[model samples]
Target: MLNPFSIEGEWFKGNLHLHTTGSDGKVTPQEAITSYAAHGYDFLAITDHRQVTEIDGLDHKGMLMIPGIEMDGGQTDLNGSYHMVAMGAKGPMSYDSGWSAQELIDYGNENAEFVFIAHPYWLSLTLADMIDLEGYIGLEVYNTTCHYGVGRGDSGPHWDDLLARGKRLYGFGVDDAHFGYADAWVGYTMVKAEKCEYDDIIAAMKAGNFYASNGPTISNLQCDGNKMLVECSPCWEIRVVCPLPGRGTTTYRSGHKPPFTEVEFEIREGTDPIRIECIDEVGNKAWSNPMWLSE
Candidate 1:
């Protein structure tokens, strides 16, 4: 089956997880919006902890503002606290620490355009803690705050484990920017949408027409039958990951004098859902959304 990248659209860079002075962030909502807009971000979500900071009246200039919130949920002791980011939320969301993971996920699914688990690796969350939760769109594969603080980011393995179990969760990379100890503009999602409008962007996100990146960018990705082709910014390695035993991953190193900007590989049968990762010499990486063979 062909990958979602074949869809035609304009790619817009956006950060879906952020905090402001409404909570514990160092900057106010206006400052956060202005900074992101000046930095050329197409869209941003000001997801304060437990409270959805209303941005409807704020002048975002040309940048699209998405209503969002971050909440703590699930069994605190067993799961180590489940943090969730809800984008395109309708109204203010109150914090309810007593809700189970599933409960919070369902609520978000019903109320928001998209919902994703945040900083799973930094929280030391296990597969068992998340595998059973339904309605969540995905997990943060890379959280810049987590990486900068405790060096625990990149939940690709955890996401792979869920994919292996037949879960169809997308992956997101975010800064989780608090603008105090954590910085912004480090990680983001490139969403392929019909336009830069709010509805279009939300639609693309819900459809998984996006890729997560810390630095490198994926220009193209195509899958035809058992063959796959990928193109990205010049990188030292391109890896194809399959969630199957014994045939887990294949890496293609760019030994060329100038490095490689593209690579192709043959897909193996039973590798139903496959994803790609491109890593540069400096260790910066980009991730493609998983492609399902049946799609």
Candidate 2:
């Protein structure tokens, strides 16, 4: 059987964070999906803060709505501002002052569910505690609402450092939708699954079989335990870098536009660990941490 990480020529694009009238947004659940689906989105997780968008008659009805919620955490005033994502999950998971944010994260992870450190570099929540949490599955590198909210240079450093440690951390980009005002479809996930379906997409996400982006689109990407292969449209260059252990490194670059001319590189065993990056014409970058085969 084919697995989630196995690329079979299928790609999924959708937003994970969004808000409806249930929270702070203006539109209702139906209107939110209506607008996004028309924009060519394949999937969407309607994450109303502290409130899960109830799909009374709309479960898997029109567009693909992956059930999810944004659990608010952190201290009262300090650096306690944090947001966490519970994807393909149903809850009862609400934000409360009595329970710490980290505790909610633990609950999600312990249940074998998908949890992403929402906008690690945004708002009052930095990449502080998320680094220490072993149960964390992924981190949001680009959050639409907070992309320009706080500033740039939020997730790049943290992701780099984690990659340096040879940790197979996955990166995700989300709209963190508070409504139409935040550009709900701003961020999307690229899956390496066989085709488009609910279970397949969810499985891909859980297996780290995808990459996150705000604008760029990835057509095909593959790695076969040695050389890495990538094909994308509407881009300029392909940059492949492996974040080796001990602060070491390895990198490969190829200049090929659409039609995706080929770019090949070698990775030696004792030459530090590795990762791959895709750089667009405007200098925008999509990165993937090295998938280590050895210690």
Candidate 3:
């Protein structure tokens, strides 16, 4: 596992999924970029539905603008379409409307720097449906629009189902914002890259050198031998999650207790890869990429 915390770089905050008036969003592309840049975002992707939202020669407000598109196809178990977000693609993007999810993933991998399934929980995807699929990097563990709009945003359990079966996929939190309500800046990914340029940010992201969060900041994380160390902003709960059910533990702060900024865990050997979660008092969470012990 290549951990972002173990890498040497400045943290760059960005949202991998978002929409503008180019598709179904309420705001224009410039307005969307302005919102993120005004809020201190270092990079942004305009993932408009089925179409490339061009930022060519447009004012980006000094932010790195990545071209992106969200594709919809492939029937799910719930009789719904599969949604995949792809960014950093080269020229002449085209696809068949009847392409299967796996085919879409193959095309995405062939064209873009990276791709991921979007809102599996919202679409009712399961391990049986996704276990055999290949080429996509990961799925959205948390979506601002899905949570606040439909109460089905958190897909950590879906992610765990894959992890338990040795899938080894990454987790991402994104704001799939259409600007209908309070869904613009709620969830995002923090990438560790040497610079805010396109190559550096995309390289770090494709290498899984990042963390997903809506709130709280993870300052440091390391696993040396069987011992684990985590340093983060004040949090109400800290958890080390292993695929094995009984191997996990939770540390929490009660009423009137001081929030925890750091924690340690002595994981029993042979648990393999484990991920960390930091939850603030209000229930917003930050998720670290998995740390593998078996490697």
Candidate 4:
């Protein structure tokens, strides 16, 4: 197991997925950045439609704005649907008519980019199958912009399954903030990066150093070789859950209400994938993706 202190060092907070006027979104990239900046988000990705914008000189004050694009290939089906997000890549990506989800993932992988399966539950795409590919970097656990009952359930299970299979897949919760009927900033992927820089934040996210949230904020989290240590809002009940290697879940629940609540649990070795979820006093909860250990 890795040292606990190093895991907590210099973790930055950010939102990896969002939409703007470059696509079907109502707000412009600048407007979206402004709103998120005011809300204390350190990084934001403007992933517009099938097109990637060239916001070369655009600046978001101290905040980092990453250029990205969302793509669609083939049609939606009960077993499989296709929509993807590619980040940190230059020039046009392949938009072939005869492309499968795995084909798209291969193209992204060869070009060295980040690939995220968007709104899996909403689209009802067989995410478990797509996750089998090593190139498929991440999955969206919660898409706040989508209709409430559109997809399967929350994406937490999708991420858990990937970890259960011993895959180091990352999880992302996006606002998909189109600024439409749904309220903007409802869901966000909180990244635990080394710094607020572009590469650091992206690297952390690609490595699954993140948690998804609607409103609640997580202050501190630590997982030693044996004990998982977490601290969060005292006003709500907190649940720390980890997917055990044998297809079961290890959970610890604690309730408190101010200064800080410390929760700990002993986890089995080799079942290193862990997630921390904060349930607010009113029952609203936010979840972090599985933080994988052992490289």
Candidate 5:
């Protein structure tokens, strides 16, 4: 059986995209950190717009902080503006309002340990705009701000479109918290890492050792031959999603019965990259990192 979650490590909750008074946020960086830390967030990146706010030597009470920035990649009347979140950034970002999405993503890839497109659904981006951009780890599957502010948040379809095209990318969930509009502790990533350190978190993120979630938690996931197993926090449904059409999706739901904590399914042949999703009664979901079956 190949199990990505079989490793020995603790799951740390983190938010990769957030803003502070450094940009358009309502609160100061200190307040933002305090609020998230109080809510039990293990790590955070203060990804203010076009600026990497240094948190060196600042006391976060034990919360790990990763340097990050959110860069703008021009805009159009129809698609709004393009945004990218760069984590573990080395220094301040060079902002140019004239840069295209590809150029911004390329620059982020060169300067940061982790880079991902932010809120494509909220930006009203089309497949034509995103299919050609490269050098990013992934796009936000859900952004709390977008969901709360305008009701367009889930970009899972956009992500699936990219995956269907054979583009290997991960999915992320972020708060995109400005505090004034969006609250903290809404959406976050659960990362499995060897240690609770900055470098270890970045390494795990790069290796796709994480899952995105608004609620619920995945405890175990495994695949062997034609069998698949999943154990998660009690949920109404557990689903196995494959990229192909005929491969379809295998879903286990409680319906009017008792909720389930785990499920087992027979994986169809030739399902290359498979992912798991656990949806609770309230519709909150936890998404596992995609696993390439060949690996």
Candidate 6:
């Protein structure tokens, strides 16, 4: 399926996970919304710690504001932690630490548009810890704060592992911006929606009509049978990744040659859900949602 590309609509840039002075962030709600709006963000969610941060009266500066919250509770298989980002809620929620991770996930899925795991690599979450959780939309494939503060940001492997094991999930990239470090404007989810309205944006996101990016742009992505084509900004490498090793291919930019803007690959047989990655020269990357041929 060509998905968002073939689905129709305008591309809207949004940051799903963000913090403000209402939580542990340095900036106030006004500052956070104003800054993001000024930075050309089409939409934003104020996912403060444990609360949605009340956006009704905020100026929002003509930008679409989605209600969100980030909460950590429950013990994992390794007794680690579970952090969840919940969006599209009409009100804030409170949960005791006594709740299990599954409990939080179930609640979010029931009450919100959808919820996602926040920074799986940063939390050191294992495949075992997350594989059983139901109703989660996906995990944070890239978190700006986690990368800058702890150097454990990228969660591509975590996403790959889950996909390989037959878990259908999307990926999200967010700033998780606290401003304690330079995190904002570093990561985003580009959603293709028919309008800038709140419901349309959330509906598009719920449908996975989007891609996660730190810098690179994925202008087009299409798959026909076993053959896939991706059109992106000039990048150093374009890789076709499969669940099984040796079934994928990578095209690297020739030294001193022009960067490649497009690449096509005939996927190996029976690769099921095919995924692709585009990596720019400076290490910035963009990821496509997994595509299942069977679907």
lDDT of 1 by residue, 185-227 (tens): 9889999988989999998888888999899999999888787
Q: C-alpha displacement of 211 in model 6, angstroms?
A: 0.2
Q: Write the per-residue lDDT of candidate 6 for residues 133-242, one digit (tens) a residue.
A: 88998899999999889998889999988989888888998999998878998899999999999889998888888999999999988888777788999998887877
List RMSD in Å for every model shown: 1.8, 3.8, 1.8, 3.4, 2.0, 1.7
What ranking emerges by lDDT with the best candidate at the front?
A: 3, 6, 1, 5, 4, 2
- For each candidate, the alpha-carbon lDDT, in order, equals 0.85, 0.64, 0.87, 0.67, 0.83, 0.86
lDDT per residue, candidate 4, 73-126, as tens digits?
755546455778787756655467467777776776665368888877677666
* Better candidate by lDDT, 3 or 5: 3
Best-to-worst TM-score order? 3, 6, 1, 5, 4, 2
lDDT (Cα, tens digit) per residue for candidate 5, span 46-124? 9999899878767886899999999996664485788899889988777786898778877888888878989988888
What would the TM-score be for candidate 1 when compared with the true structure? 0.95
Q: Would you give me the overall lDDT of model 3?
A: 0.87
* Model 6 pairs whose backbones collide: none
Could you tell me how far off, in angstroms, the CA of residue 23 lies in candidate 3 after the best superposition?
0.8
Candidate 2, residues 1-295, lDDT tens digits: the string is 1123455557777788788887888898888888888888888888888777785575443567787877776653354656778887754555564566677777666542588777766644434555556666777777777764545423756676676665557778777766645556667776776667778888888777777676655555455555556655555556555554543222323333343334555545654444455556665556553455453
Q: Which 10 successive residues of model 1 have the least lDDT summed?
A: 248-257
TM-score of each: 0.95, 0.81, 0.96, 0.83, 0.94, 0.96
- Badly placed stretches (over 4 Å) of model 2 are 1-6, 59-61, 76-78, 110-112, 124-128, 180-182, 222-226, 245-261, 268-273, 293-295
Provide the lDDT at 217 for model 6: 94
lDDT at position 98, candidate 6: 74
Residue 147 CA displacement from its true place in model 6, Å? 1.1
Please identify which of the two predictions, 4 or 6, would achieve the higher lDDT against the true structure.
Answer: 6
**Where does the lowest 10-residue lDDT sum fall in candidate 2?**
247-256
TM-score of 3: 0.96
Q: How accurate is candidate 5 locally (lDDT)?
A: 0.83
